[model samples]
Target: MAIDRQTVNRVAFLARLKIDDDKIEATEEEFNKILNWVEQLNEVNTDEVEPLSAVNDLPLICREDNVTEGSQADKILANAPMAEYGYFVVPKVVE
Candidate 1:
């Protein structure tokens, strides 16, 4: 696809870019090159190819989920600077 100065200017305005008048031609050329590369990709045949999420086909391993009460409150509270009645004490913020 051919990219013109007007198209480049419109894209620049939408993207909020400040392209100088001297660089408009260069920007248009770059846009045309990218569009040409994309057009080339359309010529490739992929009818027989299968879509894949990853290269490897290995199945993901998972573990069973279990529920249990945690019993390490004393050990966890040991690091607290100020703890009372098995809880952390901080400065009151509400009036």
Candidate 2:
């Protein structure tokens, strides 16, 4: 698809880009080249190709689920900028 000067200006406006009048021509040419490349990709045949997540497949390492609570109430509270009574304190937002 060939993008003209007007389409390029509209695209720039929609994208919130500030492009000078001189740069619009170059931007239109660049956009046309990119669209041409995408059009070329539509010509390729991929009937037998299987979609793949990764080129190499490897099983993830398995580990047993373990849960244990640790006592660090005072240590964690010490790192907070404003903590009150073993909890983090924050500024009031609701009126």
Candidate 3:
């Protein structure tokens, strides 16, 4: 797909990218290169190939979920600067 200067400019604007007038041609070339690569990928035959999430055939290892954290209110709030009624207190920001 051929990308024009107007399309490049629109993309840059939408992405909040600051593109110089001199760099517009370079940006357009990069876009064209990316599109060409995608076109090349479209030419590949993947009809018989199975879709995979990972290339390596490694099994996902998971541990049993246990109660590691004990419910000790005083111990947990020991280092807190301001804590009251089983909660951490913070400075009021809103009026």
| Best candidate, lDDT | 3
* TM-score against truth, every candidate: 0.47, 0.46, 0.46
The runs of at least 3 residues in candidate 2 whose Cα sits more than 4 Å from the true structure, single-residue gaps closed, are: 45-95
Of 1 and 3, the candidate ranking higher by TM-score: 1
| Alpha-carbon lDDT, every model | 0.91, 0.86, 0.93
Give the backbone clash total of model 3: 0
Question: Candidate 1: where are CA atoms >4 Å away?
Answer: 46-95
When 1 and 3 are scored with lDDT, the better candidate is: 3
Ranking according to lDDT, highest score first: 3, 1, 2
Sequence-dependent TM-score of model 1: 0.47
**Which ten contiguous residues of candidate 1 have the minimum total lDDT?**
62-71
lDDT of 1: 0.91
C-alpha positional error of residue 68 in candidate 1 after TM-score superposition, expressed in Å: 23
lDDT of 2 by residue, 1-95 (tens): 77999998888889999999888888888999999989987787878878778877988788778766558888888878999888889998698
The true-structure Cα RMSD of candidate 3 reads: 8.3
Candidate 3 residue lDDT tens string, 18-87: 9999999999999999999889977889999898899899999988898787889999999999999999
Q: How are the candidates ranked when ordered by TM-score, highest leading? A: 1, 3, 2
Superposed model 3: Cα runs more than 4 Å off: 45-95
Model 1: lDDT of residue 21:
100
